[model samples]
Target: MEHRDVGILHPGAMGARVAAQAVTTGAAVWWLPQGRSAASRERARAYGLRSAAGIRELAATCEVVLSVCPPAAALDVAGQVAAAGFRGVYVDANAVSPERMAEITGVFEGGAVTVVDGGITGPPPREPGRTRLYLSGDDTAVARVWALFDGTALTPVALAGPVGRASALKLSFAAYNKISYAVAAHACALADGHGVLDDLLELAQLMLPGTPLAELEHLAAAGPRAWRWGPEMSEIAQACRGVGAPSGFAEAAAATFGRWEAHKDDPAVTGQRLIADLVQGSSSST
Candidate 1:
């Protein structure tokens, strides 16, 4: 296999891991450090990703660019890449609505860039078979992206259909996975309010096997990512509306997650505080 030059547009937690996988495959992965936080820089350096001076440099150098950012920023990031004269295979692996994904693809239409829709499901790729990176687009583009991670820690699956298929699949799964966590947090809050918190956990242990309710603290653990998950839930809501499905559940879950936005990346957000935040309908608690 020929060595490929790949660019990672801002290596956050997930992006860093994905780039590291590319590095393991002998791909020279590039990242932009300008304006990125200290933690992002640390991750990029630790993962052995070469730093590009700017988006233009990254665009000018790499044969492929993979985007793994917050859902709301997906379009903006794509637009930046398009503006930077990127003319390669661009993989957007953000959790976003298919409609939003289509808009992102449109940003590069009539250009040299081949836009590959990528939707990541499961945790960050620490090992093989633990995560799936679903790709959909031109068959060649999908295959190209698939080749980047084949036999690596990230399992890339090629999907048949247009660019939006992977996004649809991702949102469809997140709509249930994320919203169910939010709903479980709400239930915990409700029980706490009624002084039955202990009782609910006892009952959940007996009846809610293999569910979020059974592992109550895991829901609180979600707080660190709620800032991004909030927008992801809204994207899922948009997807539901686009399909003529009821969007209420997703909308409500978005609001539920919004209350934890301030806790982004804060490790100290405990289950007790998470339930209290829900009960108060705010994240202002210290």
Candidate 2:
């Protein structure tokens, strides 16, 4: 279970940071370059990650593989690793529901790979105490994975349960955190459409003096990332129903996020522009 070489599948923003942290810990980090973008290649280079020709090479070479892709790709990534005959530790650190986590776990069933569920809370860790990676699985495997992250910016905490627990915790946390942002954006959009946005802002400031209008920033930031969040919201809705809770809010949040598909990742879009566009879209749709 001692992994000296770690492979990070598809080093996006969060994956790159995780690789950088592993590099700082002197672990040889590897990434697959096949089908990856130039931006991803540059990121791997900047993080000092070694490249493998493909998934098979990566799975064969590394002792541990960190699957940090989007939630939708989690199962496929696991399948790739499993098919590569990877017999080492596999960590899935995506934002997915417990049910999806269980499904991903099932992918590695009958394989030598030990599946560890990971839920990363907070943003990419740039400093100590900024984020935590919650791991749940077999005791020995979880400990091994936790040791890999020891002393890194991304603090790893071993959860006292099986694989799905970590993902359940992650989905539960994100359900509220992200859905609240969607609600705030929709509220602002409604206010803007009704010509009471300024009035609402003033009222909020007067009623809640210490709170800043972060919803505006959230909406602007969400424009590019809404595509991802839409699925995440749906997963959250599933998580809600799995726990016997009402899922109407999360379903609505998913629909609201879906409306932002047109502006997905548009750097030119501003918060005001996002709000106006969302309001206009709502108006036109009706």
Candidate 3:
């Protein structure tokens, strides 16, 4: 299989989206049966991306395979790709530390597979071609991924040296993002506890001197509808665990997402609710 004949391996919604985006670059897309998520599977179906019976089929079929599964499942998928003898690139875009990536690479180092480390920053592209994706791997073919993204709307950059640098970048970014979300939610929830969500909003607007309250508000509001975040957040938690960071913080974030899942039908998924629920932990969230 040639690079142009590369196939994409996506196991979840992000993979589906990335696979969908891959079409613009003219790569073949392949995946396991779409999961239970209607919104995600629908997107893949709409794009006419091909579906395989299992991981074995995708590995045997795609030359260059990109996987965006959660960190917990990332290594497992890599092992599967190795078992299926996937030649060419096997990029793991999971939210994991560089150390973990190295371990994952060891599983297939002897095979024909070239492991590419990928890290995705920011949200999925709402409009076509605006997503930022990064790839890092051996000196060879890293540029292939960069060029693939360059050909599309995504701004793909290839980082040189070491297989894990890209994944390290992802973990560092996730740490900051998780912290920001946790802090922002906690602060606003404190305000709400004292009957000051609005007052905090006003004071924040005035005090911060052009803060990102509006954008942050959008993220907070989308919390309830963000069911897909659960698997991703679980990966974030595992990354934190790998590095000895306190898992309590990510545990809070997970609970926040859980509340959103529980009350997706309710329109009142506000900042206070997220903060209070996350602060209270997942079990007592009801």
Candidate 4:
């Protein structure tokens, strides 16, 4: 069930990551930018991706199309797929809600292209790691879609039923994971302020890996680097609101991340550096 070609719309971090995976899995990968972001352009250059002149070109050329654009761009890309008369499975793996997934599904209704509602969990496969990609469109091409990720970090799960379940699961998972990161960030910062970050770390370790202290350390230590997570936390906060859930921690930490973003581009700084400051700064100056 190998795809002859795979096209990635939006060569952003996640998109590029997935594209790298697809190509590594032996799919002849092509890509088009969502827009012109310098980082994305650099990634495309690094990966040697064949650029599609436009959506129509990509839609006409590829057999497997994956929409990894931003959550806001999800519907637009789906519409483009429909308009271009795409002739393959379009996996909508944006971080959008269930309602949005259904809307995208409608965009491809009765079209030659089949739409699979997919939510990608975890970062792009940098190594041979596995991140479950929950799929729920009930499309017959799901098995083929699964094959696309067979040797990659993605394990595609075709969840039985409607198209929104995978998106729902994604939102739910993001909500919890974002909250967990928020809690860890807050706790570690507070403990650092109280001059007990080391003690707190020790206490966190006693939980025998169940606690996310290690992850917290990574996030905190990667301070400027963690700024990339800012928008994601904000999106997670939005997801909770859309479903009547409390997103306090995510919201608060997102604000904290906002402060970090302000200095993310500093010559001598990174999210990790700021996190280290928060974790080890002097009490009086902290």
Candidate 5:
């Protein structure tokens, strides 16, 4: 694959890693820092991404632009890129429902842009073989996007479907993976409320063994990231409802994650403290 110029819109944690991986493919990765926070600027500098004058310039120059932002901001980013006269392939890798994904595609309609639906599963691609970027849309466009990841730490998997199919797959997978974390946190909270936390942990160790115990650690680690997961859980709920599936659990998971808002980005928060807060209905106090 020939080297291509790629633009990464708003390089947050995952986006910064993606930009770095794109750099390994010999692509000149550009990021616009006009309105970004200081931390975002620092991240872009650390990742060695080239600075673009603005979104319009980034969109005008890059062969492909990747939007790896929060689901709520995905449409806005796509609209801005489209308005900037971007004619290249636009890849949206946000954790949104299929409905929202289609809406994003619609935003680029009538523009010279070709939309590629992408869903990223797994953490940042700091290590090879740990992350997969699932792509769907026009076959040729998907192939073009896939080629950009060649020889990079991120693995690209092409899916046989139209736009929104990739987002569906992503939300379906996240529905279970993230909801389980909420379930574990809720279970521990309930047990703690009943003064049976130790008993429940013992029972889980004897019955389910390693995984259940590990979830406790996962719950603790998720505290700082819960703000993001809350929106994702809500997106899962929307995806479920779109298909006439029961969305109660996902809605509850959203609420469960919302409880951790106070601890969002706080490194000092612990699993025990989160559980206790849940049981006491005092998560906001944190």
Candidate 6:
């Protein structure tokens, strides 16, 4: 299949790798360097992505543009694309509530652009079997997006529904996947309070054999990304409430993740530090 030109909205950690996969497929992946940090420019360069002069150029040039930034900026990114007269397929692959996803779709209503709903599960595609990208929308558009990563490390699955299905699936899965990490972190805190944290984790491994809870390192690593996950947990809560499901756990998980937001991208965040932040309801780093 002939690959089309693709534009990645922002080349952060996940977006850069995703763009690299598109590049590997012989597609020209573009990113706008204006207003991006030095790290983003370096990542884009490392991934072999072509640089667009600006958002307007990116919007007008690429046949497809994928938005992989923070959930809070999804709408704004869509608005910018819409305002810039982008008439191609726009894939929103951010972690967001279905309602928010619909809002993003609505941004392109009556426009020439085709909005595709996408939800990326798992981490950045460093290797096979670690990440999956869920897409739902017009079958042809989904197929087009699917083909972009068909042979890459990131697996793309087309859902059998409308625009919101992919986002709903993403938030639903994340509600459990991420909140469980928060729960385990708290468990670590509780156990440590009584001087039995290691023993508790030992037992936790038996109960959650294949899960991240089975290892303290996994839970510790979760803390540094709390800045990203906190908003996602809130989005999960909003998603649950939209579907008439209980949202208390998701809401609490959001708050729990907030306590560790100060540790965003900090490599030094440890299991004990996460517990301390939770126990104090704030990060000591603050």
| TM-scores for every candidate against the unseen true structure | 0.97, 0.92, 0.80, 0.77, 0.94, 0.95
Instruction: Give me the displacement of residue 148 in model 2, in angstroms.
Output: 1.6
**What are the per-residue Cα lDDT tens digits for candidate 1 across 135-193?**
99999988988988999999999999998999999988888888888888888888888
lDDT by residue (178-226, candidate 2, tens digit) is 7776777777878888899888777867775433244455457767777
TM-score of 6: 0.95
Ranking by lDDT: 1, 6, 5, 2, 4, 3
What candidate 1 gets wrong by more than 4 Å, as runs, is: none
Residue range with the least summed lDDT across 10 consecutive positions in model 5? 210-219
Report the CA-based lDDT of candidate 2 relative to the real structure.
Answer: 0.83
lDDT score for candidate 6 against the true structure: 0.89
Q: What lDDT is reached at residue 200 by model 3?
A: 73
**Lowest-lDDT window of 10 residues in candidate 2?**
277-286
lDDT by residue for model 3 (3-64), tens: 36455555454566667667766777776664546765677788767878776777777777
lDDT of 1: 0.89
What stretches of model 3 exceed 4 Å from their correct place? 1-3, 34-36, 126-130, 209-216, 219-268, 279-286
Name the better of 1 and 4 by lDDT: 1
Better-scoring candidate (lDDT), 2 or 5: 5
User: Clashes in model 5: which pairs?
Assistant: none
Q: In candidate 4, what are the lDDT values of residues 1-286, reduced to their tens digit?
A: 4447888887777788777777766787788765677888889878767888888898899988988876767788788778987888888888777767778888888888777888888767676655778887656777777877776776777898877788888877876765565567667677777788778777877763655565454554334434555655666676678778887867776665555554553444432345554455321112
- List, residue by residue over 44-143, the lDDT tens digit for candidate 5: 9888899998888898889999999988888899889988989899999999999998899999878788999999999989888989899999999999
**TM-score leader:** 1
For TM-score, candidate 3 versus 5, the one ahead is 5
Give all candidates' CA lDDT scores.
0.89, 0.83, 0.67, 0.71, 0.86, 0.89
Q: Between candidates 5 and 6, name the one with more favorable lDDT.
A: 6
